[model samples]
Target chain A: MATEQKDETVGTGTLGKTMAVLEAVALAERPMRFTDILAVSGQPRGTLHRQLTHLVQEGLLELRADHVYLPGLRLLKLASASWARNEFRAVAAPFLEALHAQTGETVHLGVLRGREIIYLDKVESRQAVRMNSQIGNASPVYCTGVGKAALSTLDDAALEVILSGIEFRRFTPQTLVDRAALLGELEAVRRSGVAFDREEHEPGIRCVAAPVCDAARSLVAGISVTGPAYRVEQEKLEAWVPLVRQAAGGIKNELDARLGPQR
Target chain B: MATEQKDETVGTGTLGKTMAVLEAVALAERPMRFTDILAVSGQPRGTLHRQLTHLVQEGLLELRADHVYLPGLRLLKLASASWARNEFRAVAAPFLEALHAQTGETVHLGVLRGREIIYLDKVESRQAVRMNSQIGNASPVYCTGVGKAALSTLDDAALEVILSGIEFRRFTPQTLVDRAALLGELEAVRRSGVAFDREEHEPGIRCVAAPVCDAARSLVAGISVTGPAYRVEQEKLEAWVPLVRQAAGGIKNELDARLGPQR
Candidate 1:
């Protein structure tokens, strides 16, 4: 099956094209039509149709009666299996619970997924008007507490690569759309070991976040404490900063104890 | 590009074979060798190799430096994206938190995947000696409270089909190994609207479970309250049954309110 082309070349084989199609579908936040996929993936219509049909037949993609496609449960099973084996979620679960209990605010665990932050776990507060961040939700890196917390651990070069081609959309009035302002915030996050989201992603929501690291001291994910603007005042959020950082440290210690030696 | 074969008969195509390889890797629960896949899938070596190479090159399957294969992050991203859109996890998260708060026990949201129950979400209690059940962990259907809760919703024929081929190995002394005994237990579960684990899957641990159903009155998943045997005594578990059922019902209502009308 080896072609004469170099291995690193994109779209050099059927596998590469198949992967591009899957990526396009995965990145789509909703079920998409064939034309929409072609626009996103830039694949030829003939090739895209053939690959999509193959994917649908293989159970990797499911086509609705409306002729739109979405990812199937088979993929969900695989991801769930892998996340189960990873020790980070187990270590962070208790901390997430404690954060939820202490502040009576929603807590989230997020990790870097390309230029975005994908929430791995979340604990909702018992309050009447709470934020709605379900597990597996994703948000942009520049405006979210968890995203900034995780991104703060990256070196300048790595950060540049992530920031490089992304269209920085203004989510809210408080969103730091300017690259220099975001970079400044990241610097503060790196020094203080905390990040803040003051109605950046969603209006009237405030959050404080801290990064969790693996045995190698690599920033693997982040944990956050989030609440409504009226409930979580500036002083209140500042007071919870240490608590979030402590929980993140506890998670890091547990991961190191369990998986550090193995890695 | 249409072949003479019908779409259904195109199961022998390269894409079909590639998907089979990915599914086989997921089921194996560990990195697998080329021969292990061939043995499980019953595909000819040439066809298997071609598809495996395609998958590995495409980043759906990662090839270790030593040549073993495991599911990649690309597959994980796809699954997580699908999970983000799922309404079940959202509706169950709050109830899981309430159960954890009331019982000081680990609470789980699991759905039946074939003959196993795959945990979609968990709220771990903040206790020194807590029961260990991670999100995404799969447990056998006959011995787990969540499994029984879910299985109780199935009709007799569907239940029989699921129970027909399983080799029930006893994990603990209380586990039901005989098919007739398991069926008897399931009948009890159906009558009571609750399922009991009775230390069946692990020593000194017990759980009480209830089913979450869609508006169509079909079971979509189950929720469970698990803790140490001493804390969750039979009397205490009996006391918690109503609360568990209420939480399950509330979650079902939310699911129906969100997704039922659409389906």
Candidate 2:
């Protein structure tokens, strides 16, 4: 399967179109009318109509009595199957729990999903803070602690590709908007084996994060312990450097045990 | 789009098969090697190989260095989008939170997905008890409180389709192993506008549940108040009936506000 011809496609040729319509619906953020879908899609009316009908039959989308559409539960169920089999999540959860328990702050485990850091898991502290992140939320790779930590391990060529498309929307005063400045920060993060976000993303929130790598020394994911700026000051943030790194190492070792010795 | 030709497919005409392969991989529960996938898929070697390669290229699957395959992050991203746009989860969470707070017990919000009930959200009590259900986890619809509540709202024909495939793996003596018995239970639930699980699914755990319907008077999801047998006894379970129904009504009203009036 790995070496199979890349362009050979099978079954109904409309799969890509079907999926595109689904993605459009997912992005729409509301139950969509047929006319609304027609506006989003490039497909001709007859073609789009057929695709929607088959999709409804396949349980990928639901049709309301008023003829609006929402995502069907089958998508959720399939996603759960993906989550259940993801080894990084299973391997890092206990260590994440321990780190959260030790610090009594929000802990996050994230993996690089293309140019963005996709949050795989999160443990919200009993004392909650106002944060936009949840388990599946995505954040830019140059700002947040976990994102920077994971980004630090990427080679120059890989980093260049990611840097090309980044929209450096100035999130806050502390956010790094320059690529050179970000690369410099990554260099420091690579040296120290940890990264810090001093309210770079959200005001009054800070975190220290470290990259989690496999036995091959390839970066896989990142973890962070985060708290409010008032509570987790510069000193407290620095203090988490060793703890976050240790937790990262602990996760790496567990991965190594399951995946064999380091290359 | 709904009235387009039933079988008119575009692109590669192989979308359904590709999705089926993806589903098989999802159900495999482990990173699967080529031969492993071959065993699961009915497609010949050439066809299956092409499908896998294309899927990997599409970012629906990831091929590991070990030559095994796992779900790629794109699936997770799409699922997150589905979850984000799901008004049901958003409308039901606060009510679930209040229910947990009021009853000091575990709260679950699930939706009917085919024959199974998919748990979309859960609010764990501060004083937690051992429980098998979690967010994204699923349970059978025949015996569980939330499951039965949602099932009772389905029309007889649709109900028959779901009931036809149910495997009565009795978890307890109270589990409904026969169709007639389950139908009788559903009839009672319809009359009372609620459902109860007297440790039918899991011994020492019981719950009272009610369906949440949309403004169109169609079943949307179900909510339940669950607790240990020692604390939430038969009498206590009965006491929760009104509370669950009230919360269910709250969710319905909130949904109605967003979705407009009954058709």
Candidate 3:
């Protein structure tokens, strides 16, 4: 059935408005009341009410008896499907496991998303005090090892665009505080084929990371071995560089074989 | 700014159509081509094209250069937000860990969604060989330990509604083959305050499960300790019932404290 066409200029059609409602609910840290969503969406009372009803019916959002909205289980099902079918993450999974086994540290597979990195997969360490980075959480591209490793593979112009957009919010004392400092570090990372987070993002966490590329040599993602700063000191991080690079190359080769030269 | 209202009768407004498109992509095990989605959606080419374009723009779907559509990273972001804020799952995590520690087995926390149980949280056993149940995967209520445990908690009328809908696809000889057989088992489960899966869902895998309830004593979810049947024999499964029941009760108490009687 051909649904009625919506005004192109107004909220980018029905699909756009629907996504806006979903995002409004998803982005909030807590359950949002109907009025709270109304304040954020600025939609008409009846229209917003209808949209909320539709969203709840579709399982994209759940409306509680208290009249608050939260992201629903359907999102998890969809995300699971997304995660399972993602070729890069699937190809990198065993490599992540192997790297984790070798280093006995938490392994992360993160993809560059604009000026941030979104973790796609994680193989957590068995250690009780390991760094707790949740999958799907976004971290600033300027500070994270995975972020900088991905940045190292980008062309100068693409890197410049990303750099220009980044606000160097100092996360820790060791975080690179200026564009010049980060660029200099990127130069080093490019030469070494690895990136290091020296308690740069979190106070007690550090990591060694390397970028994974496809057959076309385009950066697809980055893999990192992260741990508590005290355990993964500078010497240990340096020692694990070869292992990290090997895992990244292994993922790249598997991705290349699976994707067969991205068109 | 007020947007134009969509036809209420057609496609449940724009949100419904959008979710349809998303579900079409998500339900597919592989990346879907434009034609594949079009075929599945039965929407006009122009309408489907616009929905796909809008979905990609909103980061809810990614259209690869190869012209295949996949569920997007935005789904993961939304799912993660949903997962983090989920009160029942959050309250059950530490208890799941404790349960896993006590039994040295894989622990799963799953919630009843319709007639299926969707795993919300999982703590994998350290053993190299264990039952691989991914979080977010659904299992039939008639064949799985968690499913039967949840069914044990429901009143007869509610249980009948669910039981009537279930098609007893026998996964194994052990699976409950009909509603009468399942009801008989559920009667035993209710008396015991635990349920068992004796390789009913998947051969060589078994679990002992108990239903977690809210402050109102309403069934909220189920917690299970699953392992390979060869290792977790019937004797062990029988022995773990008390531990599983305790974990379930702990989760119920915590959830009660967190949500305060669920309004």
List the candidate 3 regions with Cα displacement exceeding 4 Å: A1-12, A127-133, A215-219, A261-263, B1-11, B127-133, B215-219, B261-263
lDDT tens per residue, model 2, A1-263: 13232222234345555777877786586779999898767667998988888777666788877798888777777777787777888888888888987888888988887778888877765512211126667788888999899888877887888899787877889999999899899999999999999888988889999998764544467999989988988898788788899999999888888877433
Of the candidates shown, which would achieve the greatest lDDT relative to the real structure?
A: 3
Q: What does candidate 1's lDDT look like per residue over A1-263, in tens digits? A: 33233323275366676766776686676778888887766667887888888877665676764577877555667666655544456678898888877888888888886777767667764422222225556578899999899888887788898888466898899999988899999999999999999999999999999988664433357999988999889899999998998999988888767654644
Greater DockQ among 1 and 3 belongs to 3
DockQ of 1: 0.25
Q: Taking the tens digit of each residue's C-alpha lDDT, what string does model 3 give over B1-263? A: 33243322245666677777887797697779999887777778999998888888777888776888888888887787787777777678888888988999888988887777888888865623211227667678889999999988888788888888787898998888987889999999999999999999999999999998664443457999999988988999999999999999888777667677555
Best by DockQ: 3
Summarize candidate 3's per-residue lDDT along A144-235 as a digit string, tens digits: 99999999898888888889878789889999989999999999999999999999999999999999866444345799999998777899
Candidate 2 chain B: worst 10 consecutive residues by lDDT? B1-10
Clashes of 2: 11
**DockQ class, candidate 3:** acceptable
Q: Which regions of candidate 1 fall more than 4 Å away from where they truly are?
A: A1-71, A87-109, A120-135, A145-157, A183-198, A206-263, B1-77, B88-109, B121-134, B152-157, B187-195, B208-227, B235-263
Task: Sort by DockQ, best first.
Answer: 3, 2, 1
Query: How well does chain A score by TM in each candidate?
Result: 0.85, 0.84, 0.86
- By lDDT, highest first, what's the ranking? 3, 2, 1
- Evaluate residue A134 in candidate 2 and report its C-alpha lDDT on the 0 to 100 scale: 68
Give the TM-score (vs. native) of candidate 3. Answer: 0.89
1 or 2, greater by DockQ? 2
> How big a share of the true inter-chain contacts is recovered in candidate 3?
0.57
